[model samples]
Target: MARKKTITKLQILNAAYEVVRTEGFGGFTARNIAKKMKCSTQPIYLEFKNMDDLKNELFEKIKNYLKQEVYSNEHTGDALLDACINYIQFADKEKVLFRALYIENHLGIEKMHKISLDFAMRLMEENEDTKNLSKEDKFELFTKIWIVAQGIASLISSGLLPMNEEDIESNLRDALSDMILGARYSK
Candidate 1:
């Protein structure tokens, strides 16, 4: 009978995240992951069907971690504006991780679809009183803010926009306020 490996799946995941966090998706190779683990790539291959399998697992983990790390109830706050700031701050603080988890297409678009929805829903629950909102209204508001904020974040990531410390702070505030106002009902 073949013996199971001693290395945990979590170790592989952590190594993968480190690769992505530091070097982006381009660095997420079996050799790189193996190097980070100081082990042969065979263990990783045995644990996962392939690199795609490992990457898929890492993708789910990234989503869950983002929810817990950046948008959990503790990160939740009393005001809509504060939540927006926190969202922006989370993006800034985890730029490389965010890029790996989000901006990169290695994990494919389906997973990103789920993550985007999860993020929007969290923002809705945190920033707005969902009990006061209709389902249609909730979807609209969430979609609106996410689309715009994601665009801004992408621009920031691409170096297309000014990302100076003060600029990021001020732009985040202004953008959050605009999104809030955009969510207001006129009728």
Candidate 2:
């Protein structure tokens, strides 16, 4: 009979996530993960079907983390601007993980895109300010906000953008307010 497994799946996944989080997906590999674990990749294989499985699992985790821990529930759909600010803050908290989450694509490249669009759509639906805008217009506007926010987070994470995290954060919040105003008064 095969030797009973010792390491837990959760433990292996945690190690894998840590490896990817610090090293970026390009740097992530079974060999690197094994180095982090101080053991062979056999245990990782045991927990997951293969490298793809592990990669997908990692993406799922980072994706869910972004949705929940980042912007899971906004109490005041009225606070659309505040919600946008909070979204950026979540990225700030988990910048590396966030970047990896947004880029990972075991299924295909567009999968990350769909996930981002879905999140933006949900936020648009919640914000009363954006509620009246046409779907396409609303998506376009929020996509801008999402891109700017992610770029800001990435820049800050990489030390390329330097500013008070708080002060610059307000810029995102204000951008949402401006969008609300634009939507409120259209040509």
Candidate 3:
């Protein structure tokens, strides 16, 4: 008798990640994941209670992946600015994932906003430029910079803009400077 092959939850999650990474949320189904893993859908069902459970886990995995692989590694010395650049670079590099999570709203707009706001607040606490600002000012600064970053990221991911690293950095820096100046003087 042949031995049975057992699939683990981690394996299913990884396959699901590949599915989402390639086909976006539209293809994020157990059947697609099973096909990607070269396994039967039975294994996926055995590993996960339902697609929603798997999807929730997958979103967490993606968040950690972004934090570890994309955001944390930026070396610009400016936490918030580095985050903006990282967001843009991630959009350029992971076009499918970027469109799925951000543009197509698979990550949920409110959740994305909360995540961005929390990350911006944390980064602002560490940034010399915005750290001392009032919470309202910090939010204003973050909102301005994030709008610019999102515009650039959206255009780049959609293939309408082909910008180099220098231009990206320059634009983000200019936006950051302008926002910071505006926040300071608007009082």
The prediction achieving the highest TM-score against the true structure is: 3
Q: lDDT tens digits, residues 24-71, model 1?
A: 888999999999989999889878999989988987887777666655
Clashes of 1: 0
- Please tell me which predicted candidate would have the highest lDDT against the true structure: 3
Task: Give the alpha-carbon lDDT of every model.
Answer: 0.69, 0.70, 0.86
Task: Show the lowest summed lDDT stretch of 10 residues, model 1.
Answer: 73-82
Give a tens-digit lDDT track for model 2, residues 1-187: 9887788788888888898677667667888888888889888887889988887887787677656766665544444454555565655666665566654443355766676678777767876667667887777787777677767766766678775755665677676677667766764
Could you give candidate 3's per-residue lDDT for residues 1-187 as a string of tens digits? 9656688899999999998899999999888999998878998887789999998898889877877787766657787888888989999999999999888998787766777788889988887777889998998887888789999999998999999989999888888988898887788
Ranking by TM-score: 3, 2, 1
* Model 3: how far residue 89 lies from native, Å: 0.7
Clashes of each: 0, 0, 0
TM-score between candidate 3 and the true structure: 0.93
The per-residue C-alpha lDDT of model 1 at residue 173 equals 60
